[model samples]
Target: MHSGMTDVTFQLRYGSNLTYECSLAADRVVASHLPPPALTDLPARLSEALAAPLEFPALHQAIVPGDNVTIVLERDTPQAGALLAAVWKEIASRGVAPDHLTVLQPASYRSQPPTDPRDALPADVREHVTWKVHEPATEVECAYLASTAAGERIYLAREAVEADFVLTVGELAFDTLLGYRGTSSSLYPGLSTAEALRRSHGQGHDELSPDDQRPLRELTDEIHWLLGGQFSLQVIAADGQNVSAVVAGQADAVLRHGKKLLAETWRFEVPARPELVLVAVEADAGGHHWSQVAAALDAARHIVARDGRIVLLSELEEEATDGILMIRDARTPRDALQPLRQAAPADLIAATQLARTIDWANVYLLSRQDHDLVEDLFMIPLEDENEVDRILDGDEPCAVIGGGQHTLTHLQNR
Candidate 1:
């Protein structure tokens, strides 16, 4: 903002709510803002959704005694404690033995002392069920299946590929590149090797395009077919981890429900573009990744004008993703993208998306990282807290996004 009010304070969402108190002209331009709906009646609502899964057996009827059932979870799944408890209770009521259950994580980079998923289960269930993480880089962990028309080799954990029934429970959100995320994604690209992922991803899709008519639907539907899945439970959230809705059934059906919720709640429509936008990430510790930052930026771009600037409010505690950290040594945005794609090691999606955002607009990062490292990636780093005041002193307009990482922002007119 070129010239604003006397004092201004914004509770920027970074992991937890970070109070961004600034001295703005009292008359600051608050262009547009939108928050998610209330997350009430979650348990009842989830049960209702499961009650009517599209073209699938009831949760209890589908499972039987002595049946080996594999439950896949995305690393990013939230409120997992509740989902795990619900799944176990439902299946147990159906007479399924805990010993017949297996929990697989295809993209989890767990710590040396992996947090036990069993801790979330009941005492009896914990003793019988098995929980394992899959490493896609290792052939022992990932088995090759078929190839897509795009030649994207389909590779997944052997357990999931050979399972009698493949089921997944995770939260699905609108992805800037992939359209909508859910079960099929949790299995295919989420479970595939780094090389396979590179092929699965093509040039970015037009996000502003109507999501319901997008081609990603067909692609995810095909993946659902390949998986031969029993059911996939997708979650919706209001604010952080406040799961409001749960949709289960086939993959495409899950995706459809998730998209519908996104259109109604997560997606925000703004009247016009702004020259300066401040995007912040205030979710959980998991939201510290570069992918989260990229998503926040992707949301901001919809309401940001050409040649405008974006103030990225990310502590970047997770730093750049393992694959994208090399950008810190690169000299320019072009340099970052070329070598990054050629590397194609891991986190290629996030690394590539970030590099593209840097090239798209003037981005100023509000982070705790080394200034030189931030600048190496062609982004301006505001190491000093007072820098925000200087920017606000200007007369230019600005907008603040409290839930940038999770909110689906779009222009109403565009």
Candidate 2:
């Protein structure tokens, strides 16, 4: 109990009367509050935003009267079914028969099987469209080796490069590797051959820097450029619940709108100084996993007074970018950079960029994983609820933000 207040719970109220509650005793509550909403009311908001008729050039249209158009959906997207429904509605309104469209999803990496594709797509559309499950290529034997005056081995994804028209539907959030995930992400890592992914992942980890052209961004840009040159694209951005506010055409235009919306929704305000900060990662939402780490670090860097402590809470259901799982175990900011630097080539690209750009060392963490590892890497002890109470009692006031498994609560000497 904190300060003799034995029963402590965090209450969140949404849309005036809708409320959700969680016990504060848990390491991560999976629910909390932030100053600004991410895409909280996605369904309602996106329906309203997309209600108007979309305007596309005649040349830009890919679905001809009888053309079989394939829709490539991203796995991490929140509400694939809802988004597909909206797209289908739009397509139908454009006079394209439901039978002319096809639906496809990427294969899963985790033990948990992917959602049934039939459940996500409408029955009518499902009947008409052929469902293709594209797994990442196991053996990428074909590598485009180029030898010029200055020889450099450049490998590209044949399948991704050959797609007729690829439409990417997903949320826009801060990613550890790519500043954001959407658009061309489906091309390189999503549809690209395994070898290309390995090459990109390896190279990204090795040569990644603090610059704008870091591996993830560079690769994303390359895929985007190629896709734009080859085929047409339809990009959508939604609020927290997968409600889309903006539907953009072309690779550049879509990414631009997405970045703007992400900046508005994801950016948080920071007090000049704070003593302690807390961040939580929701267990069910995989998309928010790494983004939560990035967000936790961002918030920690902003509010914590020099030498102040911060805590991160997460279940870590998803793997770390580039497989650098020991980031939580870093003893100091400097100490963390080395292992991140030594990461495999692809992993290094994303990890080094995140290390250089994000300030993570100031924070502590409370999680289900190895607490000692976290302490060794970040040099901050992971605390139980009782320990948190003691720390809160000694220091200043605390403020909490976040929702789902990734929650943030902080105690600061104000």
Candidate 3:
């Protein structure tokens, strides 16, 4: 804590680069931790991993002539631009025209695609390729696939299923539903119909370990088994942009290798469980989506004391605020969870999980979202940024979380 004339000055990041200055007592400022430093030479690292993928043939050997290749990417994966450029250069050398390639990003269920395809691809290569937003929520856009053992109808995006070649690029992070975001999982929950997406995601709703694997992995296995020759490129990314480590090839193999790299980079050892957890949700586009807020709470769980306080700062700019409304409407956290268990509402899985966290801790949030709406969810709302300390009310030894969605805090002695 830095010294101030009247009070201690704590300058903390409220958004990506925006700062929040709070004045509190020096003793109350218990601890501060920064995120892991970024990896150097990101492009070369991505190129190297793509050049020699584990458990799969090299890029050229994998893609043959006349193949209609589809590259799956999430909205947040700008690094896909680099991965695509590298792969495209290789494919082009072997006479694979750019017209034969399609870049697919999972569309938000029941809505139009969230991002412009041009924004996700490299400028040099963007013009030469085709881009499609995979819409599993749309009836015509999906096809009838085999149902799960649980009897959930499996409808997959037709483009991804019908494509002659599939290569997915995504970063590894702690996912609230599936343990981690691997390549296979991207196909579904984004490319599946609304019912299938909700059913699969709602399966895991408790404290999810990074190592726990079940339905998601099993589902991935079945999908690959049914539709052979699927390839994945997984990354351990810092700040969601810089690629440090990468693993590619078979989705299961990529999942295994990516998890190891992910644990090393994203996990941190905190000295003690803090009385207060302050998490800043960076203000990227769609940064404050319900899933992201829930993920931040998940990261906080690793270091927050039982019944402690958690403060979040985010823009909450996503079009939907259903989760917040769900929390507000329920009489208690348990009441809110019942519907999520029965019917998963797209990516709003966070509302159910966030309610559970609220049951354990008092969460305070700062967002552009409606204050009444924020308060209706049983969380304390911070009106002004500077009032962070005032709301903290001298709760000392607070833990401030940056990159809340992408970070995991582990206890040093636990």
Candidate 4:
């Protein structure tokens, strides 16, 4: 139980089955249910999926055997290597020469920085497959038309769009943009020129109302339409540990399958009534944005009690969430409103959606950096480990849920 109005603990649990103790406070709970582990037998699965003889004569004949095929892969994620390897094997067996294959990654965004070289592709595939990286255009300008009427002008990597056949592989996760990311993403945001993407992506940061479709679904659809049927997509949905439950082929089929799977895997059960609840953000998963932290918070709120306390754990790498400037300026929702209103209307809209999703009174964050920033922006205190420990040592009937380091173990002990 919370000793004071502001006091709470963070606990972690996994899949509603296993519980663990974490360094967080006793009243706070964290859920650490990682996506299912990567599917080790992916290659075999891909082989089985492709075993049927080719129906189209055009697909049967390779232009230059195995060496000339072009395969585009998404960046990040531990499963990338396995996914690519499976594609490679499938193509090679179909008579595409190994030397002909080229793997392409989507252009980097300003908000999402590049991955470390160490975490990049393995040497064998790196040596054989040509690599191309695209960055946003420096000189591009953003035009804000309306709530959902922003446009982007990006420079797409020519090789990616020019390929006779482009295969995009990735896991489908809920996104503020395009509803989901996979086939549609690979085409517009993935392969578009930097200028196009910049013009298009700029509006996502604008401030507007929830009813307005400006930054979210509308823009994603616009980008999707612009791709013009240049590439095919393969999307997979994984459990807590990234295990594939559904594999979809073709653009439409893949997207549909991914959406269904997302609905199934992303759901959490909530209690009808409870006095308190705790939530924490995983350092490894959350991308350091308060918005990213908000994603976890949104998941936790679904199951939290009406008057529950939700504590969020985040290592503040940057002041703003999702690279938007206004979010960094204010710590609490009330404090954020002025800056948000002062910003461009589009910016205000995006910020507003974030504000609506989070419960200002119930949220808290524990972080090493910018504790004051979080407090000022979200109205949530930044608590030290000592404070959390003190609360945990006290007597309170607390139920913890959500994810954080050692959170599961802590909950079990409680």
- Which stretches of model 3 miss by more than 4 angstroms? 1-12, 21-33, 110-112, 119-128, 137-155, 240-244, 269-272, 284-286, 317-320, 339-343, 391-395, 409-414
Q: What is the C-alpha lDDT of each candidate?
A: 0.68, 0.48, 0.69, 0.47
Measure candidate 3: CA RMSD. 4.1
Looking at candidate 4, the ten consecutive residues that score lowest on lDDT are 405-414
- Model 3 clash pairs? 30-397
lDDT of 2 by residue, 83-184 (tens): 677666656665667666656655433334456455656665677665555556654623342332334344333433343444565545444456556666
lDDT of 3 by residue, 177-286 (tens): 66776677667667777666555656353555656765776676577556564678766655434566767777778877777777776776777788888777664333
Q: Which stretches of candidate 1 lie over 4 Å from their true place?
A: 1-10, 21-30, 34-44, 52-57, 108-115, 137-155, 192-195, 201-203, 206-220, 319-331, 383-386
Native-vs-model 1 lDDT? 0.68
Which runs of model 4 end up more than 4 angstroms from their true locations? Answer: 1-68, 95-99, 116-125, 138-156, 202-241, 244-246, 269-275, 283-291, 301-308, 315-328, 331-359, 379-414
Ranked candidates (lDDT, high to low): 3, 1, 2, 4
Compared with the true structure, what per-residue lDDT tens digits does model 1 show for residues 1-414? 223346455554455556565444444454545346545776666676566777676787787766788888766666666677777777788777888888887653333223456677878679889898776677787776666677755667888877777788877877655677677767765576765555665435644454645555456557667767759887876555566577888766777667887787777776667778877665542556676777777777767777688887767756556556766667666577777767764576666667667767788888777787778777889865578656656767667776677777777766
Per-residue accuracy of model 4 over 322-402 as CA lDDT, tens digit each: 323455554644455556554433333345544543443366665565666555455455566555444445443444544
lDDT, candidate 4, equals 0.47
